[model samples]
Target: MDKNKFIKDNFGISDKTLKLVSEAEESIKEQFKHIENICEINQLRVMKAFADNRVSDSHFVATTGYGYDDLGRDTLDRVYADIMGAEDALVRHNFISGTHTISTALFAVLRPNDILVSITGKPYDTLEEVIGIQGEAGNGSLKDFGVKYVQIDLKHDGTPDLEQIKFTLTHMNVKAITIQRSKGYGWRPTYSAKDIGALIEFVKEISPETICIVDNCYGEFVETEEPTAYGADLIAGSLIKNPGGGLAPTGGYIAGKQKYVELCAYRLTSVGIGKEAGASLGFNRQMYQGLFMAPHVVSQALKAAVLCSAVFEKLGFEVDPKPNEIRHDIIQSIKFGDPDKVTAFCQGIQKGAPVDSFVTPEPWDMPGYSSQVIMAAGAFVQGASIELSADAPIKPPYIAYMQGGLTYESAKLGIMVAADKMLRKE
Candidate 1:
């Protein structure tokens, strides 16, 4: 009762809303143990990587200018590679975003006339233009550069079409295949690390020369193992998403085979300046510290996601990864089925934010997406997905993809606040 009062008084949630949330949480408590188990395994792996890399205070030294021979920058790369179980990694605060990092990796692995296969069907919305599928010509996109691209749609059950993939491999001179481990903007279940590994193996058997790259975005550190552990040639992701633990202001990472990482490094910088020139700009410590805290923070976000599923399921809404289902990423997809409800839900999320509680969010044409979007995020770091935030395309079905929670407590309040606004309208 006292806890309910605290939530009601502080967050302005009605008692009815609180009761609903409380009931939702009680039903989902069993899911927390599984999340914690994965967290523990990943936490140990990260610690082991840090220790094996012999990290010291000197590795935190800031660098400027050409950033030549910067121990901090280079050692951090080694640490990241170790964490991902890859031969090498190019970790820098310089890579713009997850999409930017993935683009670089894609460009590095493929040349003109080489065919690129997306085994995971269409990628995230931002990558559409980057892949030259939905953008103007002569923009230096892959399509502009004469690189061919194809995709194999997942079956209705959300499983890969192995026969189609095998036939495609045999018929086409495929150079590389991209595996998006997370379900981006799609209602499909996120692929598990083991599941990804099986797919990589399947592809390798058919075409040993074809490189396999995993879009390791929101899926990072969620499972006990990364795709690299299962024989991925390369993996790319945004630091601000999961590995940052909500502390890294900005950046991205690409880790995998040494040759691919080295090529990506060349693309990130210049040919010869690869992995050697980027200045850490004093962000090394935050990166290091954030990574160390990632597992625990991810667990919190996972808990929040699970709770969202449980609450919305109880409310008779359609949700992917039904309550108590194992999560491969932090994202919780809730189908509200109405644009007005989507706006209200996001606005309520803003009100629950620590940074901008007074603001109301409205839908707008966000860059890199096809539809006008409504986003509810008031994070300390702009565009930081690891903090509590939600965004929806504001189109048919009106599904809201909510993710991130620095701490479970804050995320719970945010969910409660969003629920209050949603229920008030009903």
Candidate 2:
């Protein structure tokens, strides 16, 4: 009969769940308006960047060997820097992953005996090795490079302990302050651009010279404003995450102050080579087209996250940032007390995928984390979170973090299927 009726009949949704979905649908409509406003702003940004750079068909051509004077690559960096309100930007396929991009930024800024303070507490698990907090000897981590590391744990509610942060900044040779915009694998709130802006101001007040960096993965394009707008010295993220728009094959970006980005470029290639050296190869087309499509893709993913939160919360699962809550990032987490249910949830997501549907996912000791992790990502691009994926580290809370949906419809299907499968298991 109607759309709701069709969904209800086909998905075998319970009356209770349908009622919750009805409320969610209403809430989502209001949220859509907010996203629409953001999209408009972002659209203007993309159009302006293109117009300013005079992006042409020739700009999309691939380059090889040093990629010197690669107009497309240079313009792409300009567009990224323009959109992010940064002085400069370096977008390169050479920066392997989000972790690697962040590492390059950190290393570019911090020197031997300089103190690097993480005001957001311990960063994503993958960075521990990069920071020399973990990993084997002679890896030449930040710690190994003689840069001291310190962390100020967030309060229970995920707010940084300002007193601790101030104390840490004042007492040591705090050269840089890092604020992670995403929750990472933790069950904490993601920092909004506004939140990070305030933190930047606070740091500037404490030490005007100390540089501030934002680990910006999974948080871009979700907000109307970026951390760079509010004084962040550098913001780093993977192209495979939100910025890629499901098109970029492999890459990451670092954007912010010109001098800082210059240092990162130096670290990326060599001191003299800098940003001029990296070859775009053939990624120019995808990078250009993907960035233009990013705002729309990111909006779709955000809507999917809201839907996932609503659906799972209705099923009596603990959901982070309930569906109606203001979203700073695209991630939605559902806690399953039992690790079996966690695995089942992820498996259900994989089952619903358009790709790799026949394959099953299992929890294993994934390389970057302390706990065994199970991930369900049947993305067209490898590890692309801009498509539907559900993953979680097997731990006490056993929460599955789900993010990315290229389209609202695909994500709805995936979340509903996962809910159906998990409910059946229950």
Candidate 3:
């Protein structure tokens, strides 16, 4: 189907909605110009630095010793720390997923029987099982270790209730507080790193000894500032998301104060063996390039989300598009009432994946979330990629939650193609 016909048939966007989408696209294009200019300036600096031999071209290999081991990975870690404005940073390819990174951080800080206060209610579906919440049938991380867990749900406005947070801190022997930067799944609203900073301050006031940790997975590089920038004790994230810049094959990072990084390093590699060994292979280069390209790629994803929202909202679907000055990025959700429409939309999206041509929805036991049906389309070699995921609630009034596109062009194409498919059915 042609683009216009496809849009008309599937999305049913009105003329007013098209006008708004057009305006948003133009605004994004203008923003991209600024991003290009910044990239050019940074690129020139990089080239000059390269010519001057200021940066090493040889890949840094992780060794097994403290100061003597993994000089390359260590140096990269320091560089990342400086970039993220944290006291220390540890990057490792050994972490297969974001959950691994968070688990490492938790293990480093929490002792047996220590309490983990979840400031962001429940975490992503995968993390629920690890934290010993929903999937207790098998031994999980927290359950195996005997760690206590507590959660404080965000209000409908997406703000943590300071009083509730204070109450939880006061009532529990909290060892650490985990706050997710963005809504992991579903169409719930969220706070920016800055907004989260306020909650962090509140938590600290209630429990001075409690360590503050942020699950900074999908949120990396979406904002000019990060949770660490606002006094978060530890911030952990995946290399495959915003920070990966569509470059990293696989990796994760933890950044915070020097002491936390040190402790996490010990937990990550076993206390006796530090990162000086060859734990971080093929990660430094991807991290370097990913960090360099992150802002641009994120901007593209933001554009696609905004455009999709405009189109979907016009078509009479309830959509949550981040406001002009909103903090969270790379998530756009549309509420489609019919399960069949949700399934068809997901299939259309999967057809656009870089790695796979077709995907289908399935029912599974997803920990942490109450949803039944799930669907995803990833652009990576393995199915581990979140470059795009579209799932719907299996209950009545199904709403398809769609997100991804490593590049802005691909994301835009995905939305347009999905819209086209919908229009044809209409």
TM-score of each: 0.98, 0.95, 0.84
* Error in Å for residue 275 of model 2: 1.2
Error of 2 at 295 (Å): 0.5
lDDT of 2 at 359: 83
lDDT of each: 0.90, 0.88, 0.70
Which 10 successive residues of model 1 have the least lDDT summed?
1-10
> Candidate 1 regions off by >4 Å?
none
Q: In model 1, what is the error at residue 100, expressed in angstroms?
A: 0.7
What are the runs in model 3 whose C-alpha is more than 4 Å off?
1-54, 60-68, 137-140, 322-325, 358-372, 384-386
lDDT of 2 by residue, 1-426 (tens): 587678668666555555655666676788777887887788778889889889999988888887899998888899899999999999998878999999999999999999998999989999999998889868888988898889899999889999998888788878998999999888899999998999999999989999999999999999877899999999999998898888989999999999999999999999998988777888999988889889999999998888888778878999898878899989998888889999888987887677897789998888978888999988898888889998998888888899998998878777777877766776
Off by over 4 Å in 2: 1-23
- Of 1 and 2, the candidate ahead on lDDT is 1
Candidate 3 lDDT over 48-143, as tens digits, reads 433443447664443342335555577667666765668898887777788889988988998889999888877877787778887655574786
Ranking by lDDT: 1, 2, 3
Error of 1 at 418 (Å): 1.0
Error of 1 at 186 (Å): 0.9
**Backbone N/Cα/C clashes per model:** 0, 0, 10
Q: Candidate 3's error at 308, in angstroms?
A: 1.3
Give the per-residue Cα lDDT of candidate 3 at 269.
Answer: 74
